[model samples]
Target: MATAIRRLLTAAVLLAAAAAAPARAGTLPPLVDVAWLEARLGDPALLILDVRGPLDGEDVVPFERAHIPGSVHTDYLKDGWRTTVEGVPFVLPPVDRLEVLLGDLGIDETRTVVVVPYGSTSTGFGTAARVYWTLRVLGHDAVTILDGGFLTWRADPARPVETGPSVPEPALFEAKPRLDWVVDTREVERALRDDAALLVDARPEDQYAGRTVKPGVQAAGHIPGALNLPESVFFVPGSGRLKPVRELAALVPGTVRGFAGPIITYCNTGHWAATLWFVMHELLGMEDVRLYDASMVGWAADPKRPVERAVPASG
Candidate 1:
């Protein structure tokens, strides 16, 4: 049909653009602005992965409607990006499956991937952080997150937008999982017992104080000895962009800011924790930070695990 032919032609054009794109010179930063991305739109080594989905009531923008030219669309929430492991939701999937998913998206070790989120709320921005964390865990260091995300890109009407889904030219992607980047429940338990790592609870104050609990999590409070540092504080008010380093440092509590040990971030699931991990590990250059991928959902599933309830210090 005509429609099918048009799609094929569009794919051909995108592939051609990618093929002709110039090789990028240096390592890509962990975060890139709209201007930075626009300048390298057609880079063959760059993969613009639009991970827009319904996070925090933001409606999904169909790829057929508008997207960055030569970009591929992948729903971060609905996709197999996260899987349930041992009844713990939002856990990272096995390495083999991740390899298939990335390979299908035409992502490989050589490609510098840019994850694009909806850029409406902190929760939405977390989606990008989660994906960015996943890539790093898979030993793919050539990944970056788009600051201000897709909304920032659309803010200027002059910016080019492409319609219809981009057909990716599949490449073989191999996974080299970084076991140290993620910690399991037993590791967390050991850390709690030995006080080896700084447990930073990323849930809101209410949740940390046992005032509210996320529905699948059996517990009503955070883990023992964990300090509450809500993920929202890391972002600019009413925006997806993260606050400047100085502003972020000012917001961080003295306990966390002064600590010089291994840090672990956790939330209801690993979703919000990824944001904290990105901030600490990627932004703050803290090398020893790890993500509790199973987080509270997995920890609380066992009633034997001690959950602490305490009033967080007034800011």
Candidate 2:
């Protein structure tokens, strides 16, 4: 009881601080709307990163053409943020490599970094979430995603944009790893039997049901007892923004209510699952959310691990 009360008090204090100073943002909550970002445009401590690029085509041409003023572009796909380890795709890179990557982009301990996705689709937005997760894992807490990303910024005529290259003055980046935010394949296996932890499959129903799959993953379906909640449901179709809170609350129904247990989110390679983790942990302020970085690619590769698909029961 004492521990519960202490946690509640800590959360209350955080809420109070968030309300008191909105400008000192980007740490606890991992999202910021365009309006908030527009107001803080010229702050010296702000680092805007445009992570817009195709997986395999073009340089930073799209980002070079026009971007938020003073914003630098990093190709999230090609960059070493996610790497292959012994044949697994989209796994987090080594800590030393990540520190240098962020340092080269002029990111440091003091800067409030806001990652901007292209915002074309829910899948596109996952890039921003992955980057946000990486920063948090590296122990840089002052990072958030531009909620609507570059599309919403471009929609408003008053928002200023700049073209051409931006050469950021590199800063030293140090990594203080937060091991709690991540869960490996072994931990996930344990969570399968632990009722206190909920295993959420963030892939679409087709993939979840073993009807379809993306390339490079060995599995056909999902882990046993995992619930399917596709990432697309979180975003509004035409608006290029997340649905309002009331609407978002209705989508998952009783799934999250009164459940203070840990949520472990995963997809084929941890890409799509990042979106669900962002919504549950960052947007909704759920305290215990962890991403399974190896995801199904790792889970399914081993024949000893169990996998499941939906099947009709006998009438």
TM-score of each: 0.89, 0.86
lDDT tens digits by residue: candidate 1, 1-315: 998995675555444323322222135667789999999999999999988777845465776799888898877877699999888888999999989889989999889999998788899888899999998898888889889888889999999999987798899998888879899999999997888989999989999999998899998999999999999999889887898754554555656745778889999889999999887667655558899989999999999999989875665
Model 2: worst 10 consecutive residues (lDDT sum): 17-26
The residue-level lDDT of candidate 1 at 232 comes to 97
**Poorest stretch of ten by lDDT in candidate 1:** 17-26
In angstroms, the error of model 1 at 304 is 0.8
Per-model C-alpha lDDT, please?
A: 0.84, 0.80
lDDT score, candidate 1, position 143: 89
Looking at model 1, the pairs that clash are: none
Model 1: lDDT to the true structure: 0.84
Cα displacement (angstroms), candidate 1, residue 294, comes to: 0.8
- In model 2, residue pairs whose N, Cα or C atoms come closer than 3 Å (at least 3 residues apart or on different chains), thus clashing, are none
